[model samples]
Target: MLALTNATVITGDGRTLLARATVLAADGRITGLRAGSGVPAGARVLDLEGDYLLPGFINSHVHGVTFGPLFASGAPPLAEEAIRRNLVRHLAAGTTTVLSVDGFALPEEVAEAQHLSPLTIKTSAGLTPAALTAAQAVDGAGLTERHLAASLKEQVEAGAVAIGEAGSGHTLGGGGSEYMYIPRRIKEETGVEISPAQARALKEAALGKELDPAARDEAALQAALAGAGLAGRLTPARAQALIAACVLPGLKPARRSIAEAAATARHFGLPLIAHTAPPSLAAVLAAARAGTRTIAAHTNHDSFTAGAMLAAARALKRAGAILDGATFDSFGARRTTESPANLVTLLKAGLVDLITTDYGGGFFDPLPLALKAIVGAGILPLPAAVRLLTAAPAAALPGLAPERGRIAPGYIADLTVLARADLARVRYVFIGGRQVFSSEVTSGITSSSDV
Candidate 1:
């Protein structure tokens, strides 16, 4: 249905990347990707003018829960138009594919997808339901085994794409044992949830080895460590409970959390989109326990040691795990220079991560902003950066969609046309054989013609 020619193609498919080629798209699927300068007859030719064309984005994690104080009297945050506008932003940002956070889809997505229409959406809503925090303490309540089973059944019916970033912020779930720690001061001192710095520090400290190795055995070691207060806030009793319930995924009989997420996905067989980023390690350990190869979004805000991250990745790989850099709102505000630089460093070091847009908020495609940050921060080479946003994420996309990220034959024709020098600034976007947005002009439909 469309031929994108004379363009510098940045195929996110990992194999054919940064190639100067022609991409043929029909019915929203990539029909042909020839590497020469020839065009088929009678195809409406849209010359990219040497701009860049790549697969539209696949965003993994984002909190679309009432995007305001959960207890506030706001007008049902993320209302219909709000969701629509936010989705538009995703389109504008060249995000043809996006996995909305938690279990809620935008109103537009529901309307569009219910008719069996062609809008890229996937989920495991039943197994892992995620909400920022229904109540202040609700953040702790991730999906229980019971919740996972029930929710997964419904998700299969509703067609949810994956499980969740199921943990609570200042949650009260997991026996109040393996909790997201809020410093006694922050809880008593201020109203903000958790400081990013503290989170980073904790991640750093976790890489250390201090488990009762000196006691010659596990129990005497617990006593020796407890004497030293080396266990930190994780009380021995609470830690044991957490090990049984949260940490040691080996003991579970029913497939709860990660295993539940995987089994549901594998049973009905959907890709597990674990809501993550800084939150991924916990989920990864849990999912590995369950023997599922799921994708963790955003992986987190902390600066993890490369060795630790690699070990984690290797472990995940052995268990067939995939990790994505995981983030939301490409058009969202840029982080402080110091913070973003750290993320860039991790990306460059060959850490197993991907660029994912956290869609479902203000409507804006993320490619532009995300590209800007990667480049501005000086992370990868220009082409590599583009690939990070394109090819990398596509590989992590579950279910026969790897081709979806590239401009090769048999690939899905979800593509974006943008400036080569600037991968984010959108010039035109096409998804599923439709010209979703175009910046320049449309024949017989000028603004003046409308009048």
Candidate 2:
């Protein structure tokens, strides 16, 4: 048994905040919460000294251990040591649960990796080979609907709780594929290295519009290519085709593939998590209308302007779809499409149903940084922001709520402790009632006598 006393407890139920509270736990479950130091005799005690205590964060969207290739070419699966380091990073940032949307690795492999870690991991059934090609026509051979259905069913039976990242931009072509993969592919082919700005121009030229491929200006395309040192090496037609192939490999929208994936998700009664941006909004909404409980992942993608993002998010919410906003590498950064302002707009408009960290283009923004930014900016109430990281995600995914989101009796004691002055500074973390991390211990504690 353990007692945490003299803390400001944010219960994560969206309504409770007990100042100078005491939380008691035993055998990995919260026993109770009360005011002051009500430490039961014979129980170990950790005095928080008026720090803030809350439920450990739940990240609804994440990828790294097995899906590193989504952001960089030839990036191998993270080794066990690297995976452990990543998990420690998350724990240090206050996250106790992660849903790894590994697009290529098998569910069994992911589960095996999870077994070696302390973090509670949930996985999704990533796109099948047929679904992958249908979405982007990449390297893999396509699978039939019958085969896809069978495969997903097997994964669900193997403990996959959801189906996603149904159609990734990295695989299907939006920001990730265009900016991350396309530039690398262009360098590989033409031996001309392009800047991120050039890649953005290429994306706009090739896939700016949903159905129209000829929407961009030729002069601008040439200028962008020229800026990237590809002026005389390739013809205009070839450059366009290469750019298009980098994003929309075989199909533009891949409507059939998305529909089949949605159907499979519905058949399994699992939430369908789809990648959505300005170009893919139609496909996501169509899937929602087709009766799949769809989660519009990263609704505030960098591709959409602030106003357009809010409008699209409203539409998704109206269609009974959950809008997920990712805090993608936006900590203490200037305002951009993926900045905190966009996420704030969605939250202010009540369109953001959940918050996540979606790869963050390899930076992987910590949840606490985002929470601190929003709460500090006065755009979101601190309690509400805490709930978004905890109860909201739990409620959004059904499989995680109530049990892990609130600090109450009968709930799993996964909690995070942060200093009152620095919300981003995680001081301690408890998973299943065991102290997995302690900043003080890591900083300089030498022995039991130090305490």
Candidate 3:
């Protein structure tokens, strides 16, 4: 028996609060939740000292955090040490569960990842015919015969909870090209180093946002080349050819796989988490129109202008798609997303159903910090921000959480304790009623018999 007392508890339902509460847990399940102080007799207790207790965050769209084929491109799996380090980062950031959206990992690999960490890891399957073909075309170095041969139904039976990340940056002419492939090619060919933003400018100037070859602008491409310091190193035409070569390989097949994966997910009555960005907007809207249960992953993609994103989000929501806002290191390293304004806009307008941390090249911001940014800006109250990360995601993913997203009786005792003043400062973490992390020693909180 364990008792957590004297806490300001925020139930994960988005609007329930119990000040100075005492919560009881036993056998890894919450046994009671009540306001005011009263630690039951003979129970082990951790007095929270007025900290805010919240349900552990549930992130539905994450990549590169497990020992699986990395991303939708089917690159090699991360090293075992790197995988464990990523899991620890999530755990320390107050996330208790995460769904690996890499979409190509075998069941045994998923299980091995779960076995490597205490965090509850879930997997998604995306090895349909078109999706596999796209993977092969783009970068299928990690894909094995087993991965290619596995069917969606087989993956579901083996414990995959969702179907996603159908069209990724690697396949679409999106961030993967800007941040990775295009830069690699340019460095190899011209010995020029460009940032992701610079790479994006060059790609879009030549191919446009929709990646249409007919939309090319030579003048704009020349300006982009000069801005990226490649004026003498490469001509506009040569650069366009290189960018096209890097982005167009898996483009058509990858676009086809979005609908294919959506149809397969709908056929199985599962949620389809499609990559939502400027390039994939039409297909994503079509998926929603097809009556598939769709989660528009990362609707606040850096590729979208605020108005465009809002319009796209509105259309998808009206078409029955759930909009997912992502924290792609915008609040932290500012690597992928340069600003938090887009996320704030979606949240303020109430267009976002859930919030997640998509791996920003493995530098994704913690979900707690994202919550802090939302709540701190007054766009949402703390309770509402908490819900988007906890209850809402659990509900969206169905089997992903079942009974683990709320700090209520009968739910699993996966809870996070944060400083009342700074929500990002995690003071303690309890997973399955076991204390997995504690900053209490440095936070001036000490165990005592007093209520």
Candidate 4:
């Protein structure tokens, strides 16, 4: 048995916080939690010295940790070492469970990677080619409806948990793509290479009108194109087409591909995860209406202004769909669509249903850091913030809710220990009742007792 004492336990359920408590675990399950120093004799005890104990964070949306190419450059699948390193980073950041969104990696490969890590890893079925292209417009790799359905079935049979990240703009430069692929593609086509900042500026100029590509300012578009060295090389029409293709791909067809994918996911009894942006709201709603339990991923994505995000969030909530807020590389800097202020707006308004890190544009925003920031900003209470990362995500995904994401007895003994002064400073991580990580080993009485 393992006994953890001298801690303030925030039990991820949004209503429990046992100050100076004792948590007991045995056989990979939480046996009990009670007030203070109730260690059973012969149990190994680690005195946390008043640190904050939390249920391990559960990340509902992640990519590039297993089977996906790195955010840009079309690099090869991440190597085993790279995946392990990413897992370690997540563990160090207090993430004990992660749902890796779709990519090229097989379900079996994702399972193998999970087997090697102490973190509880889950995988989603890969995306259809049309959906894939809509997100990024990659050449080739389109899938027929038949093939897409078959693949999703196969993955579900192979233990896949969800059908996710149904669409994204990263590949097409809708959100963070401006930092990478969009500029690369522009340069490839017109020999006009642009910087990441310029790409972001262009994305704002083209997509700022919210689903109305025709509302784009021609002069501004020309200036952005010229600033990227596209002057005289590409017509304004062609430039607008490129921008539209990147930011609003397939929306013109009324998001047929997204609806189809969502229907297929519903057929398989899996929740459909779709990218959430102004232009994609219709698709998200379509999926929800199609009877798929849809998750509007990154509802506060940078593409939408704060007002638009709140409105969309309320609508998604009313639709009985889940609203996922990703802390996309919003650690110390606002690197991607996720800003602390935006996330705060959602949280304060009670619009965010779950929290995750969607690749964080390759930086993989640390959940704890984001949580700490929100809590410190006085935007959200600590216990409520913990639930968004834990119970909320676990509940959002049926596969994880019952077994993990809580500190109550019979729950999986996945726990994170944070320093009292710095909530982001994870000091220890326990997975399945095993001490998988520790910043420092402390002396404790033990021999036959499990640690």
Number of the top lDDT candidate: 3
Instruction: Flag the better candidate by TM-score, 3 or 4.
Output: 3
Clashes in each model (backbone N, CA, C under 3 Å)? 36, 2, 0, 2
Candidate 3 ranges with C-alpha deviation above 4 Å: 442-451
Deviation from native of the Cα of residue 313 in model 1, angstroms: 4.9
Model 4 residue 323 lDDT score: 91
TM-score of predicted model 3? 0.97
| TM-score, cand. 4 vs. native | 0.88
- Cα lDDT of model 4 by residue, 25-69, tens digit: 999999999996767878888888999999999988877677544
TM-score of 1: 0.65
What lDDT score is found at residue 6 in candidate 1? 75
TM-score of each: 0.65, 0.89, 0.97, 0.88
lDDT of 2 by residue, 1-451 (tens): 7888888999997777899898999999999898877777777778888889999999988877542223212134666776777777787888999887754445656766776668887877755554555533553322334333456557677777777776666655665665466778888888877755577776676546462466756787787777778888876677777777766653443444556668888988888888887666888888888878988998988777888888888888878898898887766432222356677778888888889988755567778888888888887778888998898899888864349988988999999998899988899999988988888845321222223
For residues 9-61, could you state the per-residue lDDT of candidate 3 as single tens digits? 99999998889998988999999998876767777777788989999989899
Overall local distance difference test of candidate 1: 0.49
Q: In candidate 2, how many Å is residue 363 off?
A: 1.1
Give the range of the ten consecutive residues with the poorest summed lDDT in model 3: 442-451
Looking at candidate 4, the ten consecutive residues that score lowest on lDDT are: 139-148
User: What local lDDT does model 4 show for residue 43?
Assistant: 86
Residue 261 of model 2, lDDT score: 66
Compared to the true structure, candidate 2 yields what TM-score? 0.89
